[model samples]
Every structure is written in C-alpha cells, then in structure tokens.
Target: MPAFVINNHGGDTPDFDGEITFYVIVCVFLTAFGGLMFGYDLGISGGVTAMDDFLKEFFKEVYEKKQHVHENNYCKYDNHVLQLFTSSLYIAALLASFVASKVCTQMGRKPTMQIASLFFIIGVGLQAGSVSIEMIVCGRITLGIGVGFANQAVPLFLSELAPAKMRGALNICFQLFITIGIFVAGIINYFTSDIHPHGWRISLSLAMVPAVILLCGSLTICETPTSLIERRNFIKGKATLKKIRGTDNVTAEFESIVNASETARQIKNPFSTLLKPSSRPPLIIAILLQVFQQFTGINAIMFYAPVFFQTVGFGNNASLLSTVITGLVNVFSTLVSIYMVDRVGRRILLLEACVQMFLTQTVIGLILLTDLKPTGSWNHAEALIVVILVCVFVMGFAWSWGPLGWLIPSEIFPLEIRTTGFAFAVSSNMLFTFIIAQAFLSMLCHMRAGIFFFFAVWILVMGLLTHFFLPETKGVPIDAMVEKVWKQHWFWKRYMVDVDDEVIKEQVHPHVKYVKYGF
Candidate 1:
C-alpha cells in the first residue's frame, strides 16, 4: 500500500473514504461507450480505404496505380485526396473541442455526451449512404465534432465519479472500450471485406451501434456530484454522492467537494486563470502529455495498420488479418494496464513501457532498413517476424501512453479550470492526430524504413520528460491534488509556493493545511 504523509488534516487520506457501488459501475460502463465511437472510426477508416471496392468507387487513380505490377510498394497508397478521407475528422474534432468545453461546463457532462452521440448518429448515416466523395468527407467532418465532444467530457466524468483508489482503473475504462471498439471493427471489416460492392458501407454504418448505446446510456446515469455542486445544486449533489458511495456517512467527502466548488465559483475566467504561474504545472503537463502521446506514433499504427501491412509484402486478405491480430494485442494489453495502474503506480508503467517500446521500434527499423526494399517484398518468415515485432511495440504503448494520456490530464486540474484545461488537452491531441493521420502515408513513401527511427527518438524524449518532471498521482484525491501533488514535488513545488501563501490567507478552516509527502 502507498503511504500518506498527512499534514494538519485530521482525517486519514481521502483514498480510503468511499466504497464502490453498483450504480457507479453502471454509470462508468455507459460513459465509456463514448470511447467505442471514437475507436471504431479509427479502426474502420484504414480497413475501408484498403477495400478494392472502396478505392475503385472513391479513388480511381489510386486503384489504377495498384494495378501496375512494378509500382513502388511504398508509394502506391500515397494520395492527398485519399489521406483526406482518414484525416478530416481529426481536424474537425480539433476545432469542436473548444465549443465542447463551454457546453460541458455550462450544461454538464451528461448533456455534452448526449449531444456527442446524436452527432455521431447523424455522421454514420451520412457516410453509410454516401454516393459521392463530397458526401463522405462531410460525414467525416460531422463525426469529428462528435469525437471532440466525447473526448472532452468522458474522461472528466469518469475521474469525478470514481473513488480515489479506483480512479485510475475506472478512468482507463475509456481506453479499454476504445481498444474493444478497434477489435470489434477489425472483425466486422474482416467479414465484410468479402461482401462485394458494399462491404465498406457496412463497415462505416456499424459505427452507429456504439453511438446509439451512448445516447441511451447517457439518459440513465446520474450527474456527477462535483458537477452538480459546482452548478450550485448542493442538495442534489450530496444526495447523489451518498447514493454512489452506498452509505449516508458522506459528510467529510461531501464537505470537501463543497469547499472545492466554492473556491471554483470565485474564479470568473477559467481560461485566463489557467495562464497564472500557479496554474502552469498541470496545464503544461496536460498539454505535453497529449503532444507526447501522439508523437509515440501509436495513432499512425492504429489508423493505417492495414495499409502498412500491404506496403511491406502482404496480400489484401493477409494485411487485414495482420491488423486484426494487432487489434487483439491492443485490447488485451489495455486490460493489463487497468489492473496494474493503481497497484504499481503510473510512473513505473510509463518508464518501463518506454524501454520496451524503444527496443521494439529500433529492432523493427533495423529489420526493415536491412532486409526490406522499396520495390520488393519480404519472404513469409521475414514478414511474420516484422508482424511479431509490431505486436510487441503495440503492447508497450497500449499499456502506458495510450490510456494515461487521457487519464492524467483529466485528474490534475482544479474544478474551476477542469473542463477548460481538458479542452486544451483534447484539442492538442486532435491536432497532432490530424497531422499524423494526414501525413503518415506520405511519410511512409518518403522515409520508408526510417519512419520507425523517427518515432523511436520521440519515445526517448518522452521517457526523459516523464522521469524529470512528472509526479506520481496514483492515490491522491481529486480535490486534494494541489496540496498533495503540486506542493510536494521538487521542481513543481517552487511554482506552488505563492499559491500556498494565498491559500493560507484565504483559508477559513483550522484543520486544513498544505500536505507534505516524503515519497
């Protein structure tokens, strides 16, 4: 068990305060459907793009290029218009995240989620029924807006609803569901790929399944206690807290939430307040984590796994099968993360995965550089070795950056800036995702085997940053993080000193004081 260094606060750590209840479980499971929608889109696009029918119907030029027996393997799929079909959603999502922040803060997390589902449903319809390229791109843009809203709200909702001890595991349900969505989409694409003339349409239309589930689920889950209290519905907030905890003895926890909400109410402009020196740590950390997460090149792998396999040496059927194999590896690896996050702590998982990922990336790059050439294909045994190496790399990422990227950013902010801060993280993620998705095919053509080395270097930089700057937040309560985490860190502590002094002047309670942790 992790030890707590409690300062003047008379009670034990808030980590021990609440019991998990069935109601909370149902709520978490439902909210996690939002990730399903996002993930399906990620997995489906590449598979659909690889389908002969899809390319023939929408991208005839690329399809004709594929017919040339001597075409450069790396350059066969490099078309700007084709790339736009996969990348348009992320650009739309980047712009929509700001609007989501306002809706999430003003109306609440539930309504924002509901809106996300509705938009996704509309997008699925447009894409499934599309006859023209213009219609399909328009559908992708609509889906991006829904993805932006869901990404902004779901992580914050899970963090606020879970008990401190279970927060990491529960919040990871979002990532877990994302992996499941990818796996399910892979299965759908594998079976549907055999259906002539309309397999891609079937794959695109199936996205509505998760959106419909989210739409119905959002109506049943209660509003988060923190969100309720922040909106001044104190009576409902306390009642809701009691219901989720499965006990009426919620005075201490409820009081802490109320106090945090009161402090939040005093700040009128959360976005500007985020620019203050004291607020810099979480904000900067949140942004960097999102940026680094994308730089890992995980999205590039997930978005274009089918196309990538085809580029190496695999036939159309074999490439989709390899993608399915990688998808399974991703899902199971995320389950490992859910079990281990709170027990072993975030930093250890991150650091260890960095070592694992760097080695795998280096090996893959060397193999491709030495053996595989731009114009020829590798033998079956060599191709299998590359696939095995890719699975190992995917395993390393699935358990670390993939989930924690969203988890840490959601947990670190104070209530006043919570939604706004998360919006920045979401926007940063979407922007980088757009850049990578848009550029990966071209990069593959130009860089060839060297692309893996580029990502390996980024993995090294992220590991160094994690070691020097990131703090462990495993068991810290959401409301008490500023006192326990920021004020106690070696480098971040200097930034918090002035904020501590101001808190001391404004503090009304005798028991509350700055917490100092030895470990």
Candidate 2:
C-alpha cells in the first residue's frame, strides 16, 4: 500500500500509479461509513417487520380490525400498514434529496455529511426508544432525511476526491457498503426475531453503530479540494489535495479545477444551463438512469425479502437466513463490479446484468406459478429452488445496476452543475423508489409470482435504454468526458464506442457524425 490514496483532485492530468495508500483508503472507506449507515437502516427494517412481536405490539389494532375481512386493492394498503410504515422513509427521502442537494452545494461535502450524521443520531434515538407507532414513523422520517442527504453527497464526494483511476471503484464502495449494511441487518434480524419485542428495538437501534461511525469519521476528513476551491479557499484546497494525494505536484491540477469553478460561476442560471444543447445529453441520461435503477425492483427484494420467502414456504428463521444469504451475495457481487468496472467498461456489465436479470426473473416467476401453486403445494425442494433462483436474480443485479446506477450520474455531469444535477437525479431515485417500495407488497399479494414478471419486463426495457443511450466512460478523465461527450447531440450516434482517451484529448471538436454505429 502506498501512503495515501488521491481523493477529489481530478484534472487534465491523471496519475495511474494504482497505489493503495492507508490514509487514502481509510479516508474514502470510513467516510463511506455514511453509506454503511444507509445500508444498515435499509436492512434493519426488513428484520423488524419480520419480527412477530413487533407486529403484535405496533400493529395489533389494525391486525385485529382487518384479520378476517380484507379488500384487494392496488395501493390502498390492503390493510397492511407495514407497507406504509416501510415506504414512509422513502417518501421522506424523496423530499429530503432536494434539500440535501442545496446543503451539499452551499455548505460543502464534509459539512453537509456532518449534518446528516446529526440527523441519523437523533433518528436512531427516536426509533430505538419509541413507545408508540407515531414515534416510530417520526424516527423513520428523520432517518430518511439523513440517508437522503448522505445518498446525495457520498457518491459525489468519492468521484470528486479520488484519483481518476480509483474514481469508479471508490464510488462503488458506497454501494458496496449498502449491501454490507443489509447483510449485517439480516444477521441481526435473524437472531433478534426470536427475542421478543425488545429484540426488534435492538435490531432497529443497531443502525446507530454506523451512524456514529459516520459522524465521528466526517469530523476527521477534510472537505473535497474542489468544494474548497469552489468556496474560494484555494489555499486550503491545495493543501488538502496534497495531503490526500501525497504529492506536491497538484499546482497545475489545482489551477485547472479553479478555472472550471470560475467558468461555472459565471453562468447566470445553473438550472437553465442544463437545458442548453451542450448539457442535454448527460442530464437526460442521468435522469433516466435513476429511473431504470429503481424500476429494476432490487429494493423490492431488499426491503421485502423475508416476506417473499415466507410467501414461498420458508419459515421465519429460514426466511431470515435466506435474506442474510441474499445480502452476502449482494455485497460480494458489488466487489466483482468494482473490480471490473474500469477494466471492462460500464456498458457491457449493464447489458449482461440486464440479460441475466431478465432470464432469472422470468424463470423465478414461472417456477413459483407452476411448481409451488401457493395453495396446496408444499415442497421443500421447490421452495429451495425458488430461493436459489432469487439468489441468482440478486447476483445479476448486485454487480451491474446497483453500483453503476450511482456512478454514471456522479461522473457525467460537468463540475458547474454536477451537485445540482446529481441531486435532481437522486431525487428521481427516491421518487420511483417510493413508488416501488410502497406498492411492492400489494403487487406480490395481488399478482402473486406475476410480480417477478413485472420486474423482468422492466429489466428488458432498462437493457434497451442502456443499449441506445449509455456511454462507455471507463478510464476517461473527468475533464475529457465533459469536453468530448457533454456537448454532443442527445440522439447522436455515440453508441458508446471504445474511444482512446488519448485520441479523445487530441480531437478538440467532433465531426458531424460521432460514430458510424447507431443503436
């Protein structure tokens, strides 16, 4: 390992040393504790929802009222208040994303993250100590706000700070931590489900561990050099860049970043600037990418894994164990994506994942409908098959959409409007995520295995979108990407051909035709 990993100092020149220094690793990964908190909160909810005592304590009134008589409805809750309780956090996150964007742009990355940690601490406190259902809802909304802020800031923090070579993998670390959080929560849920009412509280409160880590860690790290420079503290920016980069040769690079900031500041309207022809391509791509990510229904699994397992014939303990296995596979698959993202490029991984997901989802749906008829069919062998298929479905998603979904939006936007643009994109994520998370259980209950068919169709659609619009951005310098692709026509024949970065820098302007191959 080298002494430090370069964070957030991208410019015209990129260092390809592939050095993994301890300082750089700690700074980036620990700061990613914010992501860990994101994951833990997501993971905790499923387990808590799965807890029998939790339902008996908090959901007793509704349960007794709707036990025998129920109406089949799309999202009328079907009297399952758990769906509303779970999706409420995402609803709060949707609103909070816009606010987090402003804080990210105005207060700087580290400071914005610090505020997020504060929210997490308070939210976790409320949730852990809650005596009533209303209090738990309040805690979830508060935690959602914290997560929304972290989701907005963390990916940008990684992209802006790490060396160009490390940018993709480092950004992926955030998504990776999300899986780790889910995995940890799965284990906690598994053990606590049998512990009675207090065990549910313990599971929910465990998120505090990562929340505290994020809070204390954010205090130790310096602000991103670019954020500092944008704030007109070029002196401190330069110093911080050197400390993380472990080099004194950041002067030219510093000047380049300063120049970009100055150019963006001269723009009178950040919002309208994205409407210009030069900015349309990246902005549209980023927006649609978020749509595709959520529509894939990964969160439906993450949030409702235990519920799905139980529906397919697994007992409570078995269901939680299967959830834990899913979390483990989710984390490991992300590591695979991080390893190959730069080497293999973004487009192929997305395409392959889409294909695999499409296949797995279709098959999983078919098996559930045919073999396990859900009424009289009781076969452990078929249940095990369903579980295995779900694992394969998760493996398909873990590497592709899960990581790149966050990365592409973070990197594609120009420095001037990156924060604003990305926050808007993330807000879209929360928006669709809320829709999916809220309606997922209803879909499963009403549609049965057809829910898998629903997600499979979406996976196929996302693949087409990727084929037509997504660009091959691996190993391209941030400056080069902004210059070469940002100004191109949105519908141009830029079907993500593998262009040499060196050649890209050599050609200042494009010809009328970008590439011969058109999707």
Candidate 3:
C-alpha cells in the first residue's frame, strides 16, 4: 500500500490501491453486458426500419415513398410514425432514469441490473410478436425503461469496483460492449434481411440474447462494495472488497469508503442537495457532457446509418454492408479509447477527436452539397467517399465522446449524490437522444446536406467548451475528487467554497485527516 500523504488542500488523502484480480475482471465483463443491450437496440432499429418487409408492414406510406423512383431522397423516410419507433425508447428512458436512480440507491446495483434485463427481455418478446404498430411502440417504451435502468447502474458499478488507476479502462468496457453489440447487431441484420416476411422479427427477437446474458450474469456477480457500504452492509462490503481486490489489506480503502458513506448519510435529500451552489459544478458539467454528447450527432447517425446510406444512393444490400463496415470501425476505435484513456487522459482524446470529427463532417457535407441533388443520387465513387468520411467521423466519436461520456459522469460525483447525479446525466443523454432520433429525418429533409454541417458546428462548440472547462481527472481517486479535482481546476474552483480543514476532516473521517469540500 502507498503511504498516506497530505494534499495541498491540507487533508490526509490515502492512496487507495488494489490489485487487478480475475474476480474483478469477470464481474466487469458480466456487468458491462448492459451496454450490449443498449448497443443492439441502437444498431437494430435503423436497419429494421430500412428493411422492405418492416416498412411494408408497419409504415406503408414509407414503403410507397421508398418505391417512388422520383421521390426526394432526403424526405422519403421522414414519416413521424417511423421516427416514433426509434425516439419513443429514449423518451421513456429519460423518465425511467429518475426511478432507476432510486432503485439503484435503495435496492443496490445488482438488483437494478437484473430488473433491467427482465424488462428488456419482455420488451424484446413484445416486439418479436407484435401485429400492430401500437404493440411495437409499447415494446419500445418498455425497452426504453430497461435501457434507463441499465444505463443508470452499469457505469456506476464499473467505476466503483475498479481500482482508481484502472477506472478509465474498465469503465470503458461498458462502451466496448456497446460497440461490439452494434457490430453484432449489424451482422445479424445483414444475415436476417433476406429472411422473407419475418426477417425483422428475427432481428428484434435476437436482442433478448444479451438481456438474458445480463440477467444470468447479474445473479453471479457480487454487489459493488460502495453500494453495499452505502446501504450499511459494512461487514459484507469489506469482505466483498477484499475478495475483489484479491487481498485482505483494504483497511485504508474500506475506511475511506465508509467515511464517504457516512457523509452521504447526512444528506437526506440528494436531489435538493444538488441544487446547492457547491454541487452546481458537477451537475452542470455532467448534464452538459450528456447534452454535448448527443449534439455531436453520433446517435442520429447510428440510428439512421442505413437510411442515410440509402439516401446517398446505395442499394439495400450495399447500405447494410456499409453500416456493418462503420460498425466495425466503431468497435475497433473504442478499443483504442480503452487503451489510451488512462495513459493519455480524457481531455486529449476528446479534443483530438473533435478536430477529426469536425473535418470529416465538414468534408462530407461539402461533397453532398456540391454533388448529390434532391432528385439525383451520388455516383459510385462519390458515394464511396461519403461512406469513408462517415467511418472516419464514427472512429473519432467512438474513441472519445462515446466512452468518456459515461465514464466521467459516473466517476465525478461524490458518493453522497453519485446515483442522483448520474441519474441526471443519464436522463439528459436520453432526452437529447430522443430529440435527435425523433427529428433527424425531418432535419435531414429540411437541412439537406447541411445537416452534417449543423452537427459539425456543435462539434466546434464542444471542442472550445472542453478545452476551457473540462478538467483532467486522470489518476484522481474517486473518494478524493472534491479535494483533488474540482478545487484544483481553474474555472470549477470558484464553485467550491473553502471550509475549515478540521471541520471538513471531522465530517468525513475523524481518524484519517482529509478535507471534504462544501461541494
């Protein structure tokens, strides 16, 4: 164990270190299946919507428009009901997140994840057997609720279980699984697209595979020590910590977690506490990261990649193949993030990705604006160029914003409001995702090729804001974040008011001297 040292804030901060054990690895792998469910849904919806069979069954108008030889390419799939199939999930997720927060806090992370799996399985069943549009929409709403719970718990579970030094890499497993899910879903869609009248049903039914994995896996994994401790299962918490860390030498870390939990116990209403000036920095940062993440337009593209490719003049087979290629890029790029995030830090990846994504989006927009007309499709070479550019853009997003968006929010908040704060972050992400998924087809119709430019502008804004405002959280201990991160940051420091070292130390842990910020 590393020696405890006095931080510049005049608090004794223990260096809580733990070995990477096999048990921990297994737990993370199982918990991260939650991301697979989310990713499958994201990848499946667009491909299913683009399927001739699916559109003919539920969206007859879209089927007719698609068949029209002279139909405006941008407007053919801009039906509100079609958009609802994709967007309703996110809107339901947004509302369900608040409820998920309470369940995560009260029932613990493992139970919440199990609940997510159950809901997801039911949703999948509904979608697979649906005869009416209403049944499918209801299924989407139910699946959204599952997504809400999984999103709420998985990142937090990963963050809390991981060693501080390994937190970034492990938490990214959630995103890695998400990417893999998308890749798998794309492949499944490609194979199933030719299955006659029931192809879409086969695609929808397969989503239950991941949900079942999550459900069975949740039963096998141990509850996070932080959750156990917060719920006052101290003996079990310490024992579980020792087992996961693969060592019994966890006194310093255990005490730190207990101290943090004690502080959390004082605050009866974490939501109201979030309204305090001290809490505003993390709340603002968490919410803005989610909003900016969506405004980057990644989900819009993921949800409509096949449609977008077809709009650019690819045949059905070609469009599905193109989406698969991009999905491959997305999965591989996220592996790069998992490797580099802890080594190079979050801000560097994010800023670099912004530049890459902006350039690609801009070039793609210029190509479409100049060449592809409302009535004419791009020739083979120009269409290929657009596909390559989109893959480039997806690569940038997968490596940076995709994983870090979930990672940072899950790790930033103090234990007192961790779930509450993350709930807000999840809710914000879902809300913006709902907006984009619902409106992207319409926006594409109106803005034409300019829609890519719209996302490009948002990318530029995200770059500036990240450079100026986002703090580097690399190597900072989760329990000591207020003292080491926020207080050290230039702009966010203003929101953290100074309290007497002794008083703060006493409130957190009397035996170990550590200052806790008012925030």
Name the best candidate (by TM-score).
3
How accurate locally, in lDDT, is each candidate?
0.89, 0.77, 0.92
Cα RMSD (Å) per model? 4.4, 7.4, 3.0
Tens-place lDDT digits, model 1, residues 381-478: 88889899999998999999999999999999878799999999999999999999999999988998899999999999999999999999998988
lDDT assessment of candidate 1: 0.89
Each candidate's clash count? 0, 7, 0
Q: Is candidate 1 or candidate 2 better by lDDT?
A: 1
| TM-score for predicted model 1 compared with the true structure | 0.95
Clashing pairs in 3: none
Best by lDDT: 3
* Shift in Å, residue 512, candidate 2: 34
Residues 1-519, candidate 2, lDDT per residue (tens digit)? 122221122223344332445677887887888888988877888777766688778887533532323322122223357777787788788788888877887799987788888898899999889888899989989988988888898899988887777788988999999889999999999999888759998898888888888888888877888899778776788888787778776655565566556555656677887776666677888888888888788888888788667667677799899999999999999999989998888899999999999998899889877765535434678878878888887887889998899999998876778888888888888888878878887787688778889989999998998897777877665545654554343664343333354443333111211231110
Q: Name the TM-score of candidate 3.
A: 0.96
Candidate 3, superposed: residue stretches over 4 Å from native: 2-12, 499-519
Give per-residue lDDT, candidate 1, residue 171.
98
lDDT of 3 by residue, 1-519 (tens): 753433324475665757889999999999999999999999999999999999989999999999998999889999999999999999999999999999999999999999999999999999999999999999999999999999999999999999889999999999999999998889999989999999999999999999999999999999999999899888899899999999888877877787778778878999998998778888998999999999888998899999999999899989999999999999999999999999999999999999999999899899989998899777888899999999999999999999999999999998989999999999999999999999999999999989989999999999999999999988777888888888889998998876455765566553542323221
